[model samples]
Target: MPTATPSPDFVAALREYQPLVRRVCRLYCQDADDRQDLFQEIVLQLWRAWPRYVPQPDAKLSTWLYRIALNVAISNLRQRTRRPARVGLDDDAARSLAQPTESSAYEPEEMAALYAAINRLSDVDKAFVLLYLEDRPYDEMADILGITQNNVRVKMHRVQERLRRLLVPASTH
Candidate 1:
């Protein structure tokens, strides 16, 4: 019997894919500790599935990795039980987790408000927001989410409207 060595390309692929999981986890998890844990979980899942990754000529490797990472992050059942203490803006601990932006206009409060609104959204809607914020095209977003582009547009519009309504004070309602 002949033994085959693991390819170096697999190691490189894992390294390249790590950031996608990290970013998605950061968006989904509000606290540093929870985000780190989620990242670890996602990586573990990815590593487990890596050997079975057969490449298709038509599809990009990054997209395939992204789908797996997003699926793992979005459908993670463990998150329900181990909810992060610093969810959205209310928790004082959330401040430290904010990513720095080059522009001065970036405000943690606004991000907190957005996240607070997002928390009220359904899981599917949260995926829409995450993809939208990542600047993905409607076609790609639709493909990743398993919906038509038109439906994605319509749902995205509704999601934004709902988020806006959530941000408004009760007095305005």
Candidate 2:
């Protein structure tokens, strides 16, 4: 059996926006192996779907990528028999996260705690978090998520509130 070679165009595009894909994997898979598996799955799905992709002025590449990545991650989560507890960031996952343009916003411990809390969120909420963290604008997020910009804003607020509650120590609550 032989495998079809991926086109140069697909390769180049994926290489460019891989961090977006990695962000999705990091949010969904805590284990290194699981992350790797999910990444491969996403690439495979993207490649298979490549020919069907019709680039349009209104449809940003990132938006299409997010839809696929989030769908794969959510579907992968559903197929998991055991959802791994996210205690800390794996080194690779940490390295792959989209960094702040300026100084680091959170301390290392704070970031780890934040990720753990994010892991506790439902799959849909997790999608919201991933997009928000990627610094995606509300309009782009709405397009990616197939919702109105207003809905994206509302969901983002609720997701943020959930994270705040999750981060608070039980004793503090």
> Per-residue CA lDDT of candidate 2, range 13-38, in tens?
99999989988988998877889999
The 0-to-1 C-alpha lDDT of every candidate, in the order given, reads 0.73, 0.85
Q: Which parts of model 2 are misplaced by more than 4 Å?
A: 1-3, 82-103
Error of model 2, residue 74, in angstroms: 0.3
Candidate 2 collision pairs: none
C-alpha lDDT (0 to 100) for residue 20 of candidate 1: 70
Which segments of candidate 1 are over 4 A away from where they belong? 1-7, 77-79, 82-90, 97-99
Query: Candidate 1's residue-wise lDDT over 91-154, tens digit each?
Result: 6544554444676366887766666778677777888887898788888787777789999999
TM-score of 1: 0.79
| Candidate with the greatest lDDT versus the true structure | 2
Instruction: TM-score each candidate.
Output: 0.79, 0.86
